[model samples]
Target: MSLRTSLTAFPRQALSRPNWRQTVKTSLVNYGDQRCGMAATAHPVTQDSTGSKGPTAMVFLNMGGPSTTQEVGDFLSRLFADGDLIPLGRLQSYLGPLISRRRTPKIEKQYADIGGGSPIRKWSEYQCAEMCKILDKISPESAPHKPYVAFRYANPLTEQMYTQLLDDGFGRGKGGRAVAFTQYPQYSCSTTGSSLNELWKWRNRLEGKRANGGKEGEGAIQWSVIDRWPTHESLVEAFARNIEEQLATYPEERRNDVVLLFSAHSLPMSVINRGDPYAAEVAATVHAVMQRLNFTNPYRLCWQSQVGPSAWLGAQTSDTVQNYVKKGHADLLLIPIAFTSDHIETLYELDKEVIHEANSPGVKRVESLNGNPIFIKGLADIAAAHMRSGQTCSRQMTLRCQGCTSERCLEQKKFFAGPELSSLVR
Candidate 1:
């Protein structure tokens, strides 16, 4: 069953009518208050003191997907309109909306093939919830670490998440801080850049409102970015461990010969040419995971999810699979190196399309790092490490893009640099 369908299949009781109406009324009131710019003191969502040092919120950012076939067009519209992904210098205002509307049906069909929505959001929520539990236990100093999701081009967009954090009394004072962690395992100017840009724009707007005669109790926010961690120890270990576990499922004698094919989402060749470190970082991640596994097996890193006629990073994954098959390597194991959770890219593209194209009984795919205990611990460790040092963009996690002249790579830190206060406070 589709996730939406399953979720709505619960038995309804007439006895609950009054309670449902009350709940709906309360939500409408809250929504109305927010729309009206009611002062924070009007109806603070949290009971905690706004001026007090608040809980450190770890806000994860990503490109969210449509929840239903109906939303596919809207999702595509937002994505295409983004200048970071598709730079339409002069024609963006007109051409952008045209392209999105034109592509909706085809995209909607794609969603219908894969259970009518992207499961990425659900998996991300699961991962974050699990990570929250781990953070609470291992780092009691940062015990009340709250997890928030900020999507780039969909519902729960950065603005909504910002409003939510404000409502929760998260960003108010000197010690009040939040972590803007990119959920993408490998960094790219397009994915991470687009999301962070939206967030900063929202922050600027809020600050502008405050500066222009807004209420004092409205509160100011401070936040840091967990920009990149392509080679973190725990992350490497998680991938290596999952690879090992998946490999064991194959016949013992055949495991030694199985090719490890790591596939990441492709970006336009233009981005790589302009010195985005994404491709290199992906290679580094694969290398680190391989070192951890200590495997002598043949492996190849390829790119997938190419869109548009523009040149994209090649050794296209589908082409790679066919080439390897022709070379007499039947036993294959596909690992989604870049994606952290099972989303449309993994569930539909790789799991369905690529696997079908390979058309071999020997082909298999390992599970993504969704709600994996070890992986969640790894994420917790990343956040905890940042919270300890009282820095938003840590030197330890930073990578210099080769041939990179673009300011997008390092601009977030300079723009969103927060106060130097320990976010590890409970």
Candidate 2:
């Protein structure tokens, strides 16, 4: 049977809840306020008199997935409309919507298979809130860290998150510090970069002008970024720990022989050709994890999730798995190297699709770093270090991609990195 026929044959679990959109919308409305109340009560923001930069807003940025099947349409529409991501040019306005509409059903089915929606929102919120709790204890100066999630394509979008930040008195002349901590471990122009650009755009619109018509950034939330941390020691340790735990499940004798396959979402070669740093950064992460494991098992980095017919960075993960299994190397452990938590990619793509197709008992995936204490602690360490450093962004963030020509990229870098480092961009 064709792919479409197979998809249709699968159960439509999501259809059981026709009001999923409303349910999610109502939940989102209460999510921030509820979390804020809990955070304020638990780690009350002390005054600056105590040398505390209290009530620091910690905004987690990511390319969010739809939380429900109903949201898939809008999610894909926004995703396709993003010039930084897809770049359909002048016809984008017309074609983006058209393509998204056509693709929504298939994508919706994927989400349905993964329990009717993406668990990204749930995991992101929990991770950020827990990380903030840790930050309050470790980074007292930036204590009472308020967690916020800003997804590029889903609810609690950048605009909504920023508005909530202002409402909570972080900006709009309050002059509070906020960090745009990208959840993407490795930076990608299409992922973190696009999120930052969208963030910059919203900052300009919402906090651009003061009530007295003062300068653009007068008393706005001072913004900084934790752009990339692919090889951070804590992150490496967390990944290695997960890998070790997964390896423990194998028989003691076969453990060392297992081929570790590190898989990441693929980028179109067009983006790679533009000198995007994502591919390199992902490799760095994989190598770091392997080094932490003392190279006990052989590993190879492969890419997955290529859309359309365009060339993408690969050894595609699925193809690699099939070839390995054919070569009598069925002892394989798949590690999702780039993403922090579970999503459709992990739930449906890796679990339901790839592993199911492979039909090999030896081909298994490592658990996602979702709600892992070590991983959460790593996030806190990264944030605490960034807060202590007083740097607006990483030095690497100041440098544009070798072939980048986007004016938005230039301005966004300038806005966050400030004039001092902005000079380094060309």
Candidate 3:
């Protein structure tokens, strides 16, 4: 069967399994070590001279978390310093360091509570490797896809990933293609946009104006982007399946009545007012998941993890949970809709802070879509479709926010969109 056909039939096959959870867990254990092992080793890339589009670099992008407690200080420092995410402006140079230093100790304890660090790195490696393996088989034109993780805040950063691409025989004068695949399902200037800008910045610094005068489609790693996939069918299915699993845990009669609280990382109201599409895209994911679930349970979208208290987008997840429980509506399922994998937000903020304070058994969380085979397959499908389309970035990615003022945003979009920049730019 074709990849599309298999994906269409996946839900039916999955639903037939009596112990789906156990089955998935068993597969995850068997798959994790192998994929993670592959990610650690460097492999040489050789292009096929016989008309093959092989040896493509598939770079996964995200705002990565610290892997250990000791790294939390650096993580927060980089995060605060990012003008795209926080935008402290002129005070950025001064206040960024001061704020990060003050918050590091508290953040360290939070990371400690979750474990020693975030499991983001582990899951990201596994997912990307596994997806590339599938991409090789299904999209043989883009075969031999090498998986590389580029984190914005932590190790294996954008610069490091780009350098590795060069070292691995990608773009040092020999022309090749590399896709900046954002792991964020939704499009947001603060998240995916920031990462792309950083990538563009490093590309200029490292590659310089040597190959074709830094023009795309010449001698550089001809870049493309899988910018966003908020409402992809496979994504919606994976989320719906996880929710169904959680719903099964409750008593049969109460299951239908349980409130589905779809939570995402909160953005500042200022950012929202700037016409960032993250909130709308997040809501689209929630709606798609609910439609997949047949709308059996009541649901509301809430925001979480707001910092510095500068008027964030709400109804806040924590407050919503508290108020709902206070009104005697105790059965609530918190789904971290925005994040594909678990990190401090899900492990510490939602689990430790919100649910713990709620002090009720009904306030539980759906598992993050980490290492989910369905989700991985979804990612592969998305990439395959993009490769087949031969598009630079999504058309949605070409348009800047109405209130966007940064020259970085303008150039970054132009850089990725390349020759088609004229037609794509609004």
Candidate with the larger TM-score of 1 and 3: 3
The TM-score of candidate 2 is 0.88
Clashing pairs in model 1, backbone N/Cα/C closer than 3 A? none
Q: How do the predictions measure up, each by TM-score?
A: 0.81, 0.88, 0.93
> For residue 124, what is the lDDT in candidate 2?
95
lDDT of 2 by residue, 147-169 (tens): 99999999989999988888777
lDDT of 2: 0.84
Pairs of colliding residues, candidate 2: none
Which run of 10 residues does model 1 get worst, by summed lDDT?
A: 1-10
For TM-score, candidate 1 versus 2, the one ahead is 2
Best first by lDDT, ranked: 3, 2, 1
- What lDDT would candidate 1 get against the real structure? 0.73
Q: Is candidate 1 or candidate 3 better by lDDT?
A: 3
